[model samples]
Target: MRFLLVEDNAELADAVVQRLGLDGHAVDHAGTLAAAEDCLAVAEYDLILLDVMLPDGDGRDFLSRHRDHLETPVIVLTARSQISDRVGALDQGADDYITKPFDFSELEARCRAVLRRRGGAAKNEITLGEAVFDPMAGTLRHGAQVLDLRNRELRLLEVFARAQGQILSKGQLLDRLFSMDADVTENAIEVYVGRLRKKLDGVGVRIETVRGLGYRMDT
Candidate 1:
């Protein structure tokens, strides 16, 4: 999984990033809101570990600004242990809140639990005709053969699988796969979809293009 850590404390940030890396997650660190915004603009993170206080602004403000558009889960890490602080963060759509001087183990567990719950809510395996994608393992299987997929391809598959038969626009896919600040054009999504279509064809999975509407998985 990929993560973004937004914390200004140099030492604390280093420790958290190293610990999370040791846990097998690719982590990116940002020391300020601007830096964090830049990272968020280009990368699609699985989870965001946001510090309540930053050099420029409060994390809550950032969450308020982007919560509607970004679906990635967020966990607020703050020194404020007040009930109001916790309530405000949750009300702003944070998935969880952790107080400062927190146990690293507990933080790791919370991250895992939140991700597990999200995956559980959206089934790991999606079946469309003869094709099945095991998202947890990042594998695409068809009958006896297993197809190779790139990271972006797997992310694309997850989006389609989660949506099932629903029509998803190219814009929507880009938003989900890339950050809002990404400089990628809409055509980039089409390219990825085209590549995915070829792989799906090789395995007998039916991914249909709905003309101007975009793509869908036909079961």
Candidate 2:
């Protein structure tokens, strides 16, 4: 998942970013409301961890104004623990609220719960074609049959699956496949694609490559 963390506290932002990364998410940090608005205008995020006490303005106001247009889920993180505060945030369009000094585990669970709801699942699973992907466990299933995929293949399939029918460039695929510190070249993506394709064979969906463009799944 991709998350935009809007926090003014430098230390807290760094810690949250690291924790979210370890939990297999790509996070973008914005310390001020202006910066966050700029990020939102340009990039799409799966979730937003919005801090009410932003440097430039109150995050609640931002949510109230922008929530209608933003399909992404927002979880308000704040120091306030009052019942009114939680109710107010929800009224202003927050999906979930977490008080400060919270257990990271609980935050992670909240994230999964919110995302599960967003994906329209009773549990934490996403379906595409015949594949039912469990993002939490990183597993894919087709009814009773499960495909045993390697780490790289799984990540690649994940990108394609989430993209739905959108065409993806090799550059986009590379970004999803390797972290900044990982030693990998763009050409190596094709190797992973080849392996993923073989495993996906006869799965009722196929990954189609557009000669000059990139790859996308077709049913």
**Which stretches in model 1 have alpha-carbon errors above 4 Å?**
1-5, 9-47, 56-72, 77-113, 119-123, 202-204
lDDT by residue (tens digit), candidate 1, 131-176: 7777656788888888888877877887787787899998778767
lDDT by residue (1-219, candidate 2, tens digit) is: 668899999999989988877755767889999999988886777789999988789999999999888999999998999999999999999999999989999998999899889878797666767778777667889879888986557667767876878899887877665544457787887888888888878777788889988888865
lDDT of 2 at 107: 90
- Per-candidate local distance difference test: 0.82, 0.83
Off by over 4 Å in 2: 127-131, 141-155, 171-195, 198-205
lDDT of 2: 0.83
TM-score of every model versus the real structure: 0.61, 0.80
